[model samples]
Target: MHAITIPEPGGPEALVWAEVPDPVPGEGEVLVEVAATAVNRADLLQRQGFYDPPPGSSPYPGLECSGRIAALGPGVSGWAVGDEVCALLADGGYAEKVAVPAGQLLPIPEGVDLVAAASLPEVTCTVWSNVFMIAHLRPGETLLVHGGASGIGTMAIQLAKAIGAKVAVTAGSAEKLARCAELGADVLINYREQDFVDEVRKATGGAGADVILDIIGAKYLNQNVKALATSGRLAIIGLQGGVKGELNLNALLRKRAAITATTLRARPAAEKAAIVAAVREHVWPLFEAGRVRPVIDRMLPLSEAAEGHRVLESSGHIGKVLLTR
Candidate 1:
C-alpha cells in the first residue's frame, strides 16, 4: 500500500508519498480500501509536530475517509465485504488502506457518491455534536458560526436552518459570505471588515445570538461573550487564532451563559461510537432527503496530498478538499 508520510515537521513539501505496509483489521475493526479522504486543519497541525495521533493510532494525518470494506475483524457484524462506507478516523486515513473501528463506520447515504461522501463525516459530526448536541441550539434561536465558508461552517449553516434556527456566519470576504447565504445563513458578517458582535446583535434586533460555534478561540473570546444573549452557550471547537485569553467572570455571571470547549481526536472509543450512531440515525436521513450534503472545493490524487495541504493553508476554498486513492 502507499501512504503520505511526513519525515519531519514543516510545509507541504514534507509530505512524501511512498510504499507502506498495508493495514489489517484487528479485533472490533475493519480494513477499508480507501477511496477518498479529506484534509483538515488538525492534519496541518500534526504535520507541524504540534499535534500527535492518539495512542495506538496511525501515524498518518487524515481524520476522515470514505471507502469499501475489504476485511472485518472478529466479533464485528451488521456489515460485510465490499460495503460502501465512510468513517471518522483516529488517524492513518491518508493511505490506501486503514483499519478503522467497526463502530465508527457509517453507510454512504442514498443520493451521495462514495467518493464525495468522504467529506461528510468530519464536518457533519463536528457541527452536529458541537452546535446541536453540546450547545443545545433550538428553533427560533440565533446561532453564530465563525469561518462561515469552512467545511464545518457550511454544514453548520444547513443544519441550523433545517432545524428552524436563525443562522449567522462570519467570513473574510463577500464571496464566502454569499456562499454561506446560499446555504441558508440568515446573517453574514464580513469579519475582516465589520464587527461581528455588533453585526450579530443588530441582525437579531439587539437580542444577541443564543449559540455561538467558535473556532478562533482566545482571539474571539471577549467579543463572543459580548455577543451572547441571556443564557447563551459558546461552544469552542478550534483555536486557530490562539490558545489563551482572559475571561470576564462578571459578564458570564450577568448573562448566566456557559462556555464549553472540546476536540474530537482525543475522545474515547465509546464516545466516538455514540456520535457515529447518532449521525447514522439523525444526520444520514438529511442527506437522502437532499437537505444537506458535502461541500467540496477540490479533489486531487492521493499522491498530491501535499497540494491538498497547500489549498487548505491558502484559505481560498469554501469547503472540503479531498485526496483520492
Candidate 2:
C-alpha cells in the first residue's frame, strides 16, 4: 500500500509518498481501502510535530476517511467485504488501506459518494458532539459559531438552524460571512472588522448567545463568556488563537454559565463508538433526506497530501479539502 508519510515533520514538503505494508485488521476491526481523506487543522499540527498518533494507532495524519471494506477482522459482524462505508479514524487514513474498529464505521449517507463522504465524519462528529451533545443546544436557542466558513463552521451553522436555533457566526471576511448566511446563519460577524461580543449581544437583543462553538480558544475566551446568555454553555474545541486565557469568575457566576472542551482524537474507542452510534441513529437520516451534506471545497490526489495541507494552512478553502485515492 502507498501512503503519505512525513519524512521529518515541518512543512508541506515534509509529506512524502511511499509504499508501506498493507495493514491487517485486528479483532473487532475492518480493513478499509481508503477512497478519500480530508485535511484538518489537527493534521497540520501533527505535520508540524506538535502532535503524534495514540498508542497502537496509525501514524498517518487523517482523522476520517470514506471507503469500502476490503476485509473484516475477527469478532466483527453485521458488515461484510465490499460494503461502502465511511469511518472516523484516529489516524492512518492517508494510506490505501487502514484498519479501523468496526464500531467507528458508518454507512455512506444517501445521495453522497464515497469520496465526498470523507468530508462528513470529522466536522459532523465534532459539531454534533460539542454543540448538541456536550453543550446541549436547544431549538429556539441562539448559537454562535466561530470560523463560519470553515468545514466545521458550515456544518455547525446548518445543523443549528435545522434544529430550530438562531445561528450567529464570525469569520475573517465578508465573503465568508455571506456563505454562512446562505447556510441559514441569522447573524454574521467579520471578526477582523467588528467586535463579535457586541454584535452577538445586539443581534440577540442583549440576551447573548445560548451556546457558542468556539475554535479560537484563549483569544476568544473572555469575549465568548461575554457573549453568552444567562445559563449559556461554551464548548471550546480548538486553540488556534492560543491555549491559555484568563476567565472572569465573577461574570461566570453572574450569568450562571458553564464551559467545556474536548478533542475527539483523544477519546476512548468506546466513547467514539457511542458518538458514532448516536449519529447513525439520529443524524444519518438528515443526510439521507438531503437536509445535511458534506461541504467540500476542493479535491486533490492522495499523493499530493502536502498540497492539501498547504491549502488548509492558507485558509483559502471555504469548506473541506479532500485527498482522493
Candidate 3:
C-alpha cells in the first residue's frame, strides 16, 4: 500500500506518496480499497504541522473518501465486502487502503458516481450538523455562509436553500460569488471588496441573518454578531483567520443569540456516527432527488496529492479538489 506521508511538515511539497504497510480492519471496522479522496483545509493544516491526527488514527492527511469495501472486521454487519461506499474519516483517506469504523460508512447516493461521492461526506456532515441540526435554520429565514465557494460553503448554500431558507454567502471574487448564486445563494458578497455584515443585513431588509455558518472565526466574530438577527444562531466550524477574540456579552444578551464552535475531526466515534446517520437520513435524499450535488473543482492522480494541496492552499479552485486512484 502507498499513502501520502509528511516526514517533516512544511508546505504542499511536504506531502510525499510512498509505500507503506497495509492497514487491517479492527473490531467493528472495515477495510476500504480507496478509489478517491478530497483535499480539505484541515489536510493543509496537517501538512503544515498545525493539526495532528487523533490518537490511533492514520497518519495520512485526508478526511473523506469514496471506495469499495475489501473486507469487514469482527462484529461488522449489514455492510458487505465489495459494497461501493463513501466514508468520513478521522485521517488516512490519502492512501490506497484505509480502515474505517463501520458507523462512518455510507452507501453512495443514487445517481452519484464513486469519485464524486468522495466530495460529499465531510461537507454534508459538516453543513448538516451545524446549519440544520445545531442552528435549526427554518423555511422563510435567512442563513449566511462564509467562504461560499468552498466545499463546506457550497454544500451549506445548497442544503439551506433546499430546505427553503433564504441563503446569503461571502466569497472572495465575482466568479466565486456567481457560482454561489448558481447554487441557490440569494445574497452574494465579495468579501475582498465588500462588507458581509452590511450586505447580509441589506439583503434581508435590515432583519439580519437568522443563522450564520462561519468559517473565518475571530476575524469576523464582531461583524458576524452585528449581522445576526434577533435570536440568531452562529455555528463556528473553522478558525482560518485566528483563534482569539473578545465577545460582547451585552450584544449577545440583547439579541438572545447563541454561538457554537465545533471540529468534526476531533469528535468521538459515537458522535461522528450520530452525525453521519443524520446526514444519511436528512441530506442523502436531496442528492437522490437531484436537489444537491457534489461540487468538484478538479481531479488529480493520487500520486500527485502534493499538487492537490497546492491548489487548495492557493484557493484558486471552487469546491473540492479530489485525488483519484
In order of appearance, the predictions have TM-scores of 0.99, 0.99, 0.99
Which clashing pairs does model 2 show?
none
CA RMSD of all predictions: 0.6, 0.7, 0.7
Q: Which regions of candidate 2 deviate over 4 angstroms?
A: none
Worst 10 residues of 1 by lDDT: 124-133
Q: Residues 86-179, candidate 3, lDDT per residue (tens digit)?
A: 9999999999999999999999999899999999999999999998889999999999999999999999999998999999999999999999
- How accurate locally is residue 22 in candidate 1, as Cα lDDT from 0 to 100? 89
* Candidate 2 residue-pair clash tally: 0
Model 3's alpha-carbon lDDT is 0.94
Q: Count the backbone clashes (under 3 Å) in each candidate.
A: 0, 0, 0
Deviation of model 1 at 12, angstroms = 0.5
> Distance from true position, residue 167, model 3, in Å?
0.5
lDDT digits (tens) for residues 1-325 of candidate 1: 9999999999999999988898879899999999999999999999999999999999998999999999999989999999999999999989999999998999999999999999998988888888988998999999999998999999999999988999999999999999999999999899889999899989989989999999899999999999999999999999998999999999999999999999998899899999889888889989999999889999999899999999999999998999997
TM-score, prediction 2: 0.99
Error of 2 at 13 (Å): 0.2
RMSD of 1: 0.6
